[model samples]
Target: MGWGGGRVLRDRNVVFYLSGVVVSGFGSSAMSLAAGVWTKSLTGSDSLAALTTFCVWAPILLGPVIGTLADRARRRPLLIWTNLGMAMVLLPLLAVHSSDQIWILFAVLTVYGISSVLLDAAEAALVATVVPETLRGDFNGLRMTANEGMKLVAPLLGALLFVQFGGTAVALLDAVTFVLAAMAFTLIRVSEPAPRPAKAQKWSAQVAEGIRCLRHQPALWRLVLAGAATMGVAGLNGASVYAVVDAGLHRPPAFAGVLYAVQGIGSVVIGLFSGALLRRMPERGFAAAGIMLFALGVALRVVPSAPVVLIASAMIGAGLPCVLIAAMTAVQRETPGDLLGRVAATANTLLFAPNAVALVAGAGLLALVGHDVLLLVAGAAAATAAIGCLLGSGTRAPAAAPALGGSVRVEDGGAEGSETAHDSR
Candidate 1:
């Protein structure tokens, strides 16, 4: 009730930041979809084509380490340079001519992944400083909307570009977008203070601090844990996507795109309303409700009718982003700016890493247990996670963080995070 999306939309910095996210997100989505296709084209093996996705996600394992760099540097420069650097990194993909050179694409993808982690950390921290806290829900929701909106159209555009030109064109397209994103970052108007000097500590210690920050916050941990749970099951669903399309709905393999599009549409709708929903409920409740909806969606997947499958797919899309957006908002509000980058990164690694593991495991499980069993398992795991969150929501009393600068600190019995009260008001 206290936030206005239109007010946030009117801020100049919000406009530029969202612009950068949208542009880069399009490039990222397009590149990711095209990379697998590129690999399949270069080598006839579907296994290797799938490996490209793993290459992109593998850098998330190093999120803690790379995230520390975001804390150490000026976040704006970190963001701008990372985009420019990624632009340079994608150039090598232009030279790939043979399957032997496919390794080059993989290598580039890995670098791209690492840069993405750093970018995420910087963006989270930067948003805390630049955007008003009361409007952060709307701000974050809009950000999600921008990203999901890009995901909706970018791949189709990328595929079209790939077909009309080649992998080189898609690579160049992404590179050009990175350059444009860098330019967009240059346009944001923010007065970020210099980063504090790091105390004498081991690199591992720095990484551990971020992990501890998560552990120290009760609601934040539960939210992230919930996210990781649902994400893992989503991966299980993902591994069985083709199976669902073929065996479940009697649709062809390419029809998987329709289901995916349906999911994206749901995500877009939820993302647009996430801010208002967060206002009405605590972070845990918001996330738990989404997880429950996701559980229903995945559970309904056991029904094989085309109409039911489409509705379930839409529910899956609408439900998945709630926890992630909540976690991001909570971290930004709760963690000190000095520690935000690494903590944000650590949270991300936790929330997303399980999905990667489950993808492989679900694939193996599919060979034996089949898609229906995996879907049910995923649904149950998600429901169990939601119930845990709802039950645990009442137990924790998070300590009030000290005010930094001229900001005020307030804690409303841990229903949600309240970091800088001056901004919050």
Candidate 2:
């Protein structure tokens, strides 16, 4: 498994798919960062600038519904056309010359958000069809590393482009990246199975299948719940970064970027090892360990020293991504191919909704409470989640054998693979 797992990275198709993801993700990150800046410049309103990001995020609320599009259509073609559509959407932004046309930018961002929902769902489904199961953990980890790395670099490039040539140039650059991504997607060659016969069900009923699939899998249910709980607290915890830099460590606000870079470095390193860790540990245990590490990282932030805070930031970065990768890999490994899109989308909504809410409420909550208190609260929440997973490990059921239509069922008292569940205990 290990030898084959490692070699999956060398597969041409996997490389092509990941390459497209990285290129498109980098461009998307740049455009997203510039949206706020462009809005602020055009209207000189901080509120409106903030609204630009919100506009991009708003379509995530429709993930389950939009994800149905992915499952109903062929995933690779869906991805190719989606990227093409987003490229055209960005083209209109090149013509934005005044505040009167600011709405056009917002509209494009909304399209970006909508595209993001479908892309995420489609990618998960497509990867399931193309990538070997043994390599899934590594693939997810590498994808995360790529995304985190982009966050560190893309904003700077976006700012530079916006300053030198204006928002139009940024849009043009983003459009070119999308075209490249489309070309990359087109390069991928996989013998996808014919589409499953359409179920004679209502739209609402189709959507319900996703939720039912998760609920029927006990292991997936526990993993998803743990992630949601962590995200709920992590949202509030994220607000403490600026506070820790500004007030706790007595540093300039810009210092937060340095800390973010440090965190991203940690995330990238841990992501490399995630596949190996998943091989040795149950996804639940890996997720639990990550949450515990994150809790410790949060607790360490109480120290006023800069070095301590930086170390804590790295720990937090490394810790949170473990949970995310574990949950995603579990979904990919366990889900049936035909239902993978909706299930992936539903899982995303479950995992990310709390983060969105927390981000929205983070500023107000920080104002209402002390930074130390918030950190402790976040740590406590995370610790509680980790402990819950630990205590439940011995009692929980194992993953069941794959069921009808190639769906793997995770019931109590069975193992996910040949590995023993007691390894977690």
Best by TM-score: 1
Report clash pairs, candidate 2.
Answer: 397-412, 397-413, 398-412, 398-413, 398-414
lDDT string, candidate 2, 1-425, tens digits: 24223454555555666677677767888888788999999999999999998887788777788778778988878878988988888899978988999999998888888888888888888777655565567678877777787778988989999999999998998898888878877776655666788889998888888879988887787788889888877787777788988889999999998988988888888777787677667788888999999889988887899999999989989998888888888888788988988888888778878877887687788889888888898899999988776665331222321211222222232222110000000
**Over 4 Å off in model 2, which ranges?**
1-6, 392-425
How many clashes does each candidate structure show, in the order listed? Answer: 0, 5
lDDT of each: 0.81, 0.77
lDDT of 1 by residue, 107-220 (tens): 999888888888888888887876656556677878877888898899999999998999999999899888888887777655678899889999999999988988998878
What does the lDDT read for residue 336 in candidate 1?
A: 93
10 residues in a row with least lDDT, candidate 2: 416-425
Best candidate, lDDT: 1
